[model samples]
Each structure stands twice: as C-alpha cells, then as structure tokens.
Target: MGPHIKGKIKKTLSSLAGQSAQSLFPDLFQNESAKAESSTVIVPPPPDMNWLAHADFGEQQKRADSAPPALLALGGKPQQELIAQKLARMGYVVTTASSTAQALERLSANKYRLVFCGADAAFEEVLRFVNRLTTDQRRHIYFVLVGADLHTFYDLEALALSANLVINTRDLPSLELILIKGLRDYEQLFRPLLDILGSTP
Candidate 1:
C-alpha cells in the first residue's frame, strides 16, 4: 500500500480502538465526564429552614398542648427515662419519679390518669399505696407494675390480685398498646357510672 493509504488505515484502526475502549468501559468514561461537568457546575446549599418551614408546627404544638399527664414511678434513672420517653412519644405528658414516696407526693399534688411503677420500688410499698388509693375509691387512676421479669419479682397470683396491670421492661415496644388497653379497660369498668351520671339531672 502507498504511505498515505497506510496512514489512513492506521487512523481508522485507532478510531475503532477508541470506540472499543469506550464500549468496554462505558462507566469509566461517563464517570470522568460527569466529574468534569460537576466541577464546573454550581450547586446551591440547601435552605436552612427547609424542614422547619414545611413541618406542621401548629398541629404538633396543639397535640403537645392537649396531651394528658401521666406519672412514671420507676426506680433507675436509665429505665425511668426510657419509659418516660416511650410514653411521651405516645402523646402522654410523662413525669418521672425514682421512688414510691416521690411518686405518691406527685400523685397527691397532681392528678394522673396512668401510673407506671417499676419493681425496683419496694413492691410492698407500691401495693400499700395502691390499696390506700383503692380504699379511697379513687379508681380513676390506672396502676401498672413494670418489671424485667414479672415472675421473678412478685408471685403471679398475688400480683394479679394487687396490680391492675403488669408489664415486662424488655417488651418496651408494646408499651403503647399496653397503655391503650389499660385505658380502655378502665373506661369500660367505669362506663356504668358514666351512664348513671349521664342519666342524672
């Protein structure tokens, strides 16, 4: 072949090799081009109030304002905080107490629809408190006993006799459901009295 034709053949082969390389490593070529284009492009920073501006702050505040108060009479700080947070997430305004005495003080000072007492508190003290409240005919308050293992702490039969409800701490995920069921039970128990009151002048 002539020298000019030979050069043309070589150029054609080089062009074909470039196309083959691009086909074999398409991602590599695309990524390099993308990087180059991105380097020259200007991406504006996200707005500072993006989430806050779009959030339903008014509804959240209204719900917070309307949540009912509940008492968490637990023993350890960690467990108390954990239980309190869980209840708060369920929309209850939770107040935490480390001891039975503190819890009783809070109960006397403020009304609470629900009381969650941990086994860490003296069981006898909790029982006596519950008994006193029952004697006073204050059935509006629903009592629950929190324990890591219910059987480990109290005799199942005795506990069933004393406590309104028993919960295992390990089952924290079900805490909201337990609270709802307890509340429903309390409402059902008092439905007759509510009906009587409604019937009265």
Candidate 2:
C-alpha cells in the first residue's frame, strides 16, 4: 500500500484499539499498567518504501493540521494574550496580530481554520476583509467577532457582515466551550466529504 493509505490504516487501527480498550476496561487509559505497555509498544515502519518521502509527508501533514489560528487583537493586547495562553494550554496554536493590517497580511499568506477579530477594529475594515475572501475560502474558515456586548456590536450593522460567529468578550471564561462547539460544527459541516474519503478504495 502507498504511504498515505498505510498511514490511514494505522490511524484506523489505533482508533479501533482505543475504543476496544475503553469498552473492555473502562479505566484502561487511567491504569498505570496500560500506560507502561503503551509507552513500550513501538512499531517499525514497512520495508521497501521511500522513507524520506514518507517522513517529509508526515511532517508536512503535522504542520498543516496543528497550525495555529490567527487572532486580530487590535487594541486588546492583554485580553488577546490571555486568550492566546488559554488556547495554547488547550492544545490550540494561536498567532496574534496587533492591528487589522497585520492580521490581513498573515491571513493573505496562510490558511487558518479560525480567525478572531477584536471589537476595537473598525467594523467597516472587518467587513471589507471578510468580503475579500472567496466563497470557498470562507467555507473553510470560521470568522469570529468579539466584543464586550453583542447588542452594541450588532446594533452597528456589523451583524450584516460575513462573520460565522459573534462572541462577547465578557464570556471569555467560556471561550474554550465556544471553541469546542465551533470545531464540532465545522467538523459536522465537512463530515460528508470526510466519510467519502474514508470509504474510497
């Protein structure tokens, strides 16, 4: 099998093994014996393959999959830094920009799954940025506008803009839950294509 297919098979097997272990022994993950066994288990790569190509492809995939989302803090430095730290602790990578221009530059050069814009940013500027993205690009990204109050933010007609989500900065304590929901929604949106890919011969 090709390296891509091999990797997929390995992932599938690993997932199945995890599920089986969890069902058979509810505390398997928390057991010291299971942890020790897992630590010692290592599988060698298949022979007669281009190891370099496989390694490179794996590295590229890791970088792409684990890349951080971009954050436009504008004038909210302290708030943005706190949010970034929280997200990092939760296993999310975040890139913070001090200004809308800087955020736009980063967005132009990279593909981010999520983008958070601070309410301090001009509503018109945020709208323009969202409008610039193509329909397909917009589909892949969740644009969020964060503010102190949704009422004031939406009253400015910014609700008519192309943001996928609107978050109140006051609700920063629940930011993790919001992020989890957003990710789940995004996954559900693309699940059909993922199912087709997994089933392909």
Candidate 3:
C-alpha cells in the first residue's frame, strides 16, 4: 500500500521470477536478467480428458466450416477465369493453372479446398495425377471438372475417376444456388466427377 511496502513487494516478485527461471530453465538462466528481460506466458498442454478434447474439436470445426476455403482452377479458359473471379467475390481464395503441368505444379505448392479443371484434360492424366498426390499429408482438394461441351468434351471415365463434380462452365450460378439449397440435390449432375474427389481412401 505505501511506497516502502510496494518496493518490498516488487523486490519479492523480482526474486520469485529469478527463482522460477532458475528452477525451470536451469542453465539457460545463467544470464539471469538478460533472459529475464523477456516476458513469457505459460500455457500448459491441454488435458487428455475427453471433455477438453471435445471442446477443442468443436472450436476447430466451427472455424473450418465457417469460412469458404481456397479454390484452384486447373485450366486456362476465359470461362474458368470468370467463374473463379465470381467465386472470389463470394469469399473464396482462387488460384488458376493453364494446363495439367501447371496445375500439377500449383497442386504441389498449395492445398485448395476445391479444384475446377477444364473437362478435356484426359481421364488418365487426372487419375494418375491425383493418385500421385494422395500420399501427401494435406491432400484435401476437391476436384470438379468444368466445361459446357459435355457431349463433345466430356471424359466419362476420367471424370468418374478423379473429380468430385462435373460442372458445366455455364452453370456456375445454378450450381452455387443448388449448393446453397443442398449439396445432395446437385450431386446427381455432378456425381461421377464429385464422387472421386469426395471419397476417402
């Protein structure tokens, strides 16, 4: 309360801090005040209890599901650009690739929440491509094949093999509207491609 008592309290605290560092960090405290000049916060490891674990899990799921994730477009087309920009406006981060080779390079470097590939990029290429990526730790990119020329441009087997959705480049708005309503509703049109990307293992 008074100056003398305040000084005594400060002194006691200083001594206690020194003793704490000496006990916890040991020889690292050889410099004492030099290291002591740094302030620290002690956050102990979380308890192994399930309630604490559940709380953390709930927090993480809340964060992940709340925000729109990044998107990658693996083909160079005006439609892809327009669609990606539209998605970006809707709060998704978008990156585009001009070809399968470029897409491969981009895939190596970044993890996208979704991928929209030009439908013509060969089924084997997409399959072999994604197959190579599966062993990597963070391979959660959802693949969607994009093109309106499905009759002439679609690869049924390849679309079935690697993509999660087969979206007509022209149907971007309809797809978004459909997705807002329910992902299951749009799964019919997009299923062959969507299944490959959505399936685990």
Candidate 4:
C-alpha cells in the first residue's frame, strides 16, 4: 500500500480500537466524575470536646442510663418484645406487631427507620412489607433480616432492592455494622449530592 493509504488505515484502526476500549470499560471513564463527586464531604464540625475521638466502641454498647430513643418500630410476635425493648433503650420509637399483617399496616401508616422481624415470621410477609416500603421516594430506610440466612432466600438482589442491609439479631453488629458503614460510604460517595440537598433545604 502507498504511505498515504497506510496512514489512513492506521487511523481507522485506532478509532475502532478506542471505541472498543470504551465499551469494555465504561466505569473507568465515569470514575473520574465519581471521584470528583465523592470528594466534597463536609460533615458538621464535631463537638469541641472531641468526644468522638476518645469514644470507645465498647462503651457505645453500654446500657444507656437514659431511655433509648425510638426511630420507628415494627409490630411482630411477643418474642419481638425483646427486640422492641432492646431498641427502646437505644433511643428508637418502638412499634409492636403481633403478626405480619399488622406490621405492614403500621408501615403504611408510619415512617420507621429500622425494622426488626421475628424468626418465625413469614418471609413473604416481610418481603411484601419491604416492597411497599420502597414505593416511598422520600424515605430511605434500613432493614434487618433478623435470623434468616441468604440461603433461605436466594434473591439477594430483591431483598437488597428494599433493604440497605440484612442482619441476624443473634449476630452482634455483624450485618448491622456492614449496613451502617455501607450507608456512610454512600453518604461519602455522594457528598456533593448531599450538599445540594442541604443548600436547597
């Protein structure tokens, strides 16, 4: 081929290769934008006492001397009373449920930040309640699976679509901690979006 023809062929191949590369790795291109968005963390200044720095994780579990604050409570079996009282001492608003039907009704009527379910409760009942919860575009609540295994339900994506994390009440901060940290990571990753929310508020 002539030199001019060869140069034109090479440019065409380069263009094709560039398009293929982008198709194979769209995230690499988007990551710069993600990093830029994630860099804007601006948490409110900690108390001047620097209490958080000296705070001990073990101390956090210490039974609060004061009544626990309630976020929101789900109604469930009598056994759930244990879950209710536990959260009450931690400062969550405890809602009680004797059955799954009652629990779903409460969710429709109120906004609950955390949901604790009994081991005996029907899984479909819980999933349905969660599905209803997701319809609210305004609130993003965290849900704990409470004693069920991932194996019990293979639909991890479906569960997570409604819940930020799932936990076994028996496990100490295992799934719950993961959920909390995941949320913090999300908040960190979307700090710019948060800034916009705050500004508009």
lDDT at residue 100 of model 2 (Cα atoms): 67
Candidate 4 regions off by >4 Å? 1-79, 118-123, 133-138, 148-161, 172-201
Candidate No. with top lDDT: 1
Candidate 2 wrongly placed segments (more than 4 Å): 1-68, 121-123, 151-159, 193-201
Ranking by TM-score: 1, 2, 4, 3
User: Per-residue alpha-carbon lDDT of model 2 for 15-88, expressed as tens digits?
Assistant: 77746665767775568776777788554432322322333232222232344565554445567876776677
Instruction: Estimate candidate 4's alpha-carbon lDDT, on a 0 to 1 scale.
Output: 0.50
**lDDT: which is higher, 1 or 4?**
1
Which of 2 and 4 is the better model by lDDT?
2
Q: What's the TM for model 4?
A: 0.47
Ranking by lDDT: 1, 2, 3, 4
Each model's lDDT comes to 0.63, 0.61, 0.53, 0.50
Per-residue accuracy of model 4 over 1-201 as CA lDDT, tens digit each: 899999999998877774665576788868876888989976443123223234344644434324422232334434366655556555556666655667667767776656655434464576566665433432345455555443222235324445544444444333323333444554565567657666310
Clashes of each: 0, 1, 4, 13
* Candidate 3, 59-171: lDDT as tens digits: 22222233455544445567866676666655566677666767777767766666666666442365466666644332455556666653212335334545555655555
TM-score for each of the candidates: 0.55, 0.54, 0.47, 0.47
Clash pairs for candidate 2: 68-93
Q: Global CA lDDT of candidate 1, please?
A: 0.63
Between 1 and 3, whose lDDT is larger?
1
Model 1, residue 139: distance off in Å is 0.8
